[model samples]
Target chain A: MPRFSSNHLETLLTAVDTGSFEAAARALSITPSAVSQRIRAMEALAGQVLLQRAAPIRPTTAGETVLRLARQVRLLDEEASRALDGSGAAVPSLPIAANADSLATWFLDALVEVRREADVVFDLHREDQARTAALLRDGTVLAAVTAERRPVQGCVAVPLGIDRYRAVASPAFVDRHLPGATSGRDVLARLDAVPLVDFDRDDDLQQGFLRRVVGHAPRSPRHFVPSSADFARAVELGLGWGLLPESQALEPLAAGRLVELAPGRVADVVLWWQHWNLRSTLLDAVTAAVRRVAAEHLRPSPV
Target chain B: MPRFSSNHLETLLTAVDTGSFEAAARALSITPSAVSQRIRAMEALAGQVLLQRAAPIRPTTAGETVLRLARQVRLLDEEASRALDGSGAAVPSLPIAANADSLATWFLDALVEVRREADVVFDLHREDQARTAALLRDGTVLAAVTAERRPVQGCVAVPLGIDRYRAVASPAFVDRHLPGATSGRDVLARLDAVPLVDFDRDDDLQQGFLRRVVGHAPRSPRHFVPSSADFARAVELGLGWGLLPESQALEPLAAGRLVELAPGRVADVVLWWQHWNLRSTLLDAVTAAVRRVAAEHLRPSPV
Candidate 1:
């Protein structure tokens, strides 16, 4: 077998992948003739035709093999470059793998900090806290605020804080529906006939709270408001009484846009930060920043 | 925060990553002015600085954040393109994580069959069998061949086959060194004292085999031949006797170039295919092609 230079293979693969020799040449910033020459040389070396010359040109079987390797070589190069570039005077990117609420509330500020720091890069993978560990497990993300306490394999887990939840209803709806302030089972039984706002099909917290409060499963009609913020909005708009994150509900509650339906009861979910175990300086920098931010914003856990 | 068009970000990232506006423009196959305009537009929208215009331009912290996302966006696009392209008429590029032995042997041929049958592209990750699962878990690869019997979380595992290994020496070395056929403990114990070829410092197979054959571990002074093929070549050149894969040894043995120093007793390593549990057609097609090729080339496991 004739030994072909990696650069030669790269030129040919890029040409075929991008479709036209002219386009590939443009992409590679080489002359079209150079791209052509590289392809011809590779073909002669392998003794096989590589690419089909047509619109949106395609790779032949042999070409695909080399093309695959070419892409890998490129990715490895990119990764190595990222590592090398970050090795000196590089600040860690404030990458936060958070759900909708945190992103909408505090994550943007984190992004701002990332921009202000030394050359840093952010990699955000949006996922629910219950599911963010999967991102950590896959190495798709560097840090995650997750519900799971146990660390995913090859990761470190640190307790961040808790997000408390409370049942709230629109003031108008509560006054009109309840007619009188009653914390008794008789008043609670009437809620079974009232419409309730559920976060989504997967949400059980609202129903679960109702069940525990009333000593039975919820028999109430439910409206599905999927987004965490939207679910709160739906409740404020009098769509239904529902559980809302305390951080989210505080402003509305204080403004009387929402009335606390269950003042004494609260659902507190403990959240943890899970991240890869790589001794990357960037990872440590981001971790420290995130820990500081989380401490300032979230409720402290009881010792 | 200003929303960035994925295309514009991709262009900017490629430009800085490749270095020089002209080089980046060449990489993206657009005019240098277009590259310059894109970066200017991004900086204006973000109302902040982006790239540092040094000899080879570099991303500022904000620029790096966008660049990281640009890389992710490109990868996602490639993956989506592969999925939408499908198999049968065209095989999409199949992303696989496999060990060095498989890549050097039959894996490439199987990929060729996949390309012939479908509109496929491939992203192959070369890793150790023990570490291949980490690639799959990280979502960096679609599939992998792993030595671990237990499947990585969220992945399904199927038997690929077994690779059998045996200790062998070149006829010239055996003649010069041994002079007479010997299977005694003295000969085996002196194996380490003799110069031997090893795949790497981590490779213990040769020494492990020697320890099993003799009462003590072999104490051979060793030379490291990193590549799987090169390790076999080193032994063939009489650099030292080492464990060789049966498939790799077949041609040399048939040509009378190699003789099995210790035959009958060989090591068998079972291999398994593991892939993510996703409702993806591209993954299914690659799995089928892989299974077919494995059946054809690998030794069948005993029931």
Candidate 2:
């Protein structure tokens, strides 16, 4: 086996990050030619083309393997540095991805706990819960809050809890749109004529709930309000009826500001926390904080 | 031909928006049974299932056609009301979608001009430029700023001009990452070793620029910062080099805070304004304001 040079791997990582040989040189405080020489040496040692010479440069398949290795090495180095230093001022930045609703709700509470205990800077990527695990796969984020139950390769999946949603609208809107109690069939028939609220174009929670209740998707005209807080507010203002997390809807429901459309029906979305399996203090710290918050705020997973 | 009852259509629209039969009845100031009777009558008249009997209710295919007709009728009614009112204080809320970069740049200026001239409440939806047109197709937005050149059905597309970007980094970052002069090939080769800044995982501007310069993609470690202003700031802070809009880069470039990586290389993204072709004074006023601002701020479209 060819002996891999840590210095060469570091150079490769820098080149990809800076996007050009000259930029990499600048980042490492070395001559651009030296940066080039190191990469060429590594390529010769690996006996394969690692990088595709494209603008902004991307790694070939071989390059991806090396990039992952380099990142792992860097993480280990950082852990060692912290351990040796003991002051922990040289804290590493933790990049994580989360869905918008989670970010708007209990995710911030977890972040607060993490920040209070650790001297770290957080870089957050807001994405759909279903797509967040892709960030972890691409190595964009170290951890993610996602709806996918399966763990990504080299990662561990922990069941956080379920996000329960209720269909709700303002009392005035209910009175104005649906005046009297009718059969379930009548309720379903009137759904087509009603206006509904959506989180965004990709959001199908309302439709999914509709399908579960009536065995078909609701084809009502919808007002798409992407923000969680504003979506609940839109329902309150009688703009449209929408599905709100039980946590968000509970208070409004209690105050009679909003009422559940179907008294017994609820949409429960199970959430999972996925993170690298590597044993790192920072990662462990973040995991503990997130799990603790989830226990407090989210509903327990059904058996 | 069956005579469509506008009153029944209005009832349907109210029911869909209100999310419950009772809510629609309340909105119409009638009993819930009355709301149900009107809908049943309309369904009998149409001789088709107009609504799916689902929770929150959805329109069937036939119902979608009627829903569109109802919205058009509503728009026309609003226009007529404005013509008769003359004061134009009863302005309709106009929801539009735009990418984050445009929102952070000259888009707000156009919005300000629109607000100054018209009595309009803007419900702005921030999304990626590439995906804004989907909102228009789903009837979520009346107007959008997008990279798609094709006009949505029932919508007209107007060229808004090009947004040009430059590859830039802090002078200090350049000094630190690249100490000495080197050939372009050498510069390309070293790119793999440097750190790069990304707006998000989907952001490929830097990689696109790299591909254009080096003929391959860079596989460097990257820091994903999703905000536009913060993205530019990260580059200035020596976190990494990235592509910034010429509008954003110019001031920093002039102030010696940022330097272009490839002297003559630039990325130009063409933008277009798309909106419903309906004849409304308010929509016309907004279109005019946006065009005028784009003419002043953005580069002319390439012939």
Candidate 3:
């Protein structure tokens, strides 16, 4: 097999990807003839016609093989540079803009595995679960464990499963707020009217729970705690009753730090994993780890 | 806004992504102290604690914003390089391994779009649809449009919808080959037993269609045509019956170039956009366009 030069491979890949020799030449700062010759050389080396020289040229089967390899070479070269530099991180840190509850509960653990094994890193961006995809579209993160299923532009969505949340509060908070509250909209309205801790302005967990329970959301003065742990702490300190991740609230509930505001009726937020569409090795490895963890932990979404 | 250097942003992004200053420093070819200093500098500049500085150094919200920007900058730079290079012909052609049917149909159009727009070129590698992931795992394609939902290790899957295929043959081929065919199984088995043209040794469209028509795939002598257009032409030249893309077959069949062997029973393959999970702006833009096209053309999965 003729060892195609890196320059040739890059050129051929670009030409085939770009479709026309002229366009490819322009992009590479070479003459169109240079692009043509390079492609010819590559095709000769591959022992097959790599591109169909149509209006916008397309790759032949043989061409696709080389193009894939070219991408790998670039990625590997980048990783190598980072490795050699010692000041540049080789492991691609996937910035995941996720909700606080997911972050505090299972998401962090998923990240831990990726970090330990994949030689990658993460920048976790906490956002309202409903709005995580906004971060994705804004190019804030490479991937997000989000609550949205509709993919952002230039991104793909995978069903990461659902997080079931129950309305919980400290015993003292519940006692002070709901004193022998009876059934029906009257009692539920009372729950809604009380002070509640929310993740942010966009958090629907508390309101969603209320709409389901009392036929309408709790019209309470809300405190946006933002951080999952901090939000939980606010509920524990009797700042207000709020929705909490079942996993995060377990220990605190057991120790009487919180109480189940609603026994049966709670809210379930379906979470999806949305990531930027890139052919990235490190990101891929991390995504796999996250998916594996999500499948194990989160509830299957109805949709 | 403080003009955070891409280098500084890169370092901070690496640390957050890697989960520790030490590991991030190692990846970036720098010392932990330098990583620490950079993070401190960023935090001091932003007037917010960007990193938690705990066991696994986690990025704070502000830190995540910077990290997201870093990814964007890097991706943009790569795309800019591809654009400037035109076809990337001056360098080694980037290999892009894809399935046979995609090469025959929508994939080429997508590549044409990339050519006209991004100005990069491609080296195409054609593999069996079921086996493209292996190529990716083996470091073949930088990006792939694969059938696998579970991503290959170090690769991410973007849903590109399905490629529906129909078992097709030339009218002359069918007339000579399947004389007095009644039962679908016998007809399919006989069809499979006859010599057929395939894209390659790994081409399963013929056998896979046979298996679907009958209960099992019939082993038969096959000629590998390799190229997408040639594969379609081989069937048109009365060589054998095989699965062809509906899009490619439409013209041929209408022109009496080929005939549908299995009329009602069309095999629909769910095609996904799988690429190296790299954070590249150009890749993202290309992926977006591809997905839009796939959605417009391909059938949505019934499940």
Local accuracy of candidate 1 as per-residue lDDT tens digits, B190-297 = 565555666543456676776777657454545444455545665776656778777788889889888877667787778788987765555677788888887877
Best by TM-score: 2
For each candidate, report its DockQ versus the true two-chain complex.
0.01, 0.08, 0.01
Over 4 Å off in model 3, which ranges? A1-77, A80-91, A129-131, A182-189, B1-303
Candidate 1 residue B268 Cα shift, in angstroms, is: 1.4
> Can you give the lDDT of residue B267 in candidate 3?
76
lDDT of 3 by residue, B67-102 (tens): 545655544565666567653322222346667567
| Strongest candidate by lDDT | 2
Local distance difference test, per candidate?
A: 0.66, 0.74, 0.66
Candidate 3 residues A1-303, lDDT tens each?
568888997787667546688978876889999888988888888889978899777766666566656654545565566667753444333345766566556765565565444443344555665567655554445678777789987788888887878777777666666788654334465786666666554455676777767674344655544445545655666666777777777788898887776577667778888876776767777689888988888887676
Weakest lDDT window of 10 consecutive positions for candidate 2 chain A = A86-95
Model 2, B1-303: lDDT tens per residue?
255677787788777756678878876889999988888887888798877768777777766656656655665666677678864324455668877667667776676576555544455697786667766765556788887788988889999999998878787767756667355455555665566778765577787777667676565656666766556666776667788988789999999999877767788999899998777777788899888998888999773
Interface RMSDs of the predictions, in order, are 24.3, 8.3, 27.7
- TM-scores of the models, in the order given: 0.40, 0.55, 0.37
RMSD of each: 29.5, 13.6, 25.7
Which lDDT value does model 2 have at A71?
Answer: 63
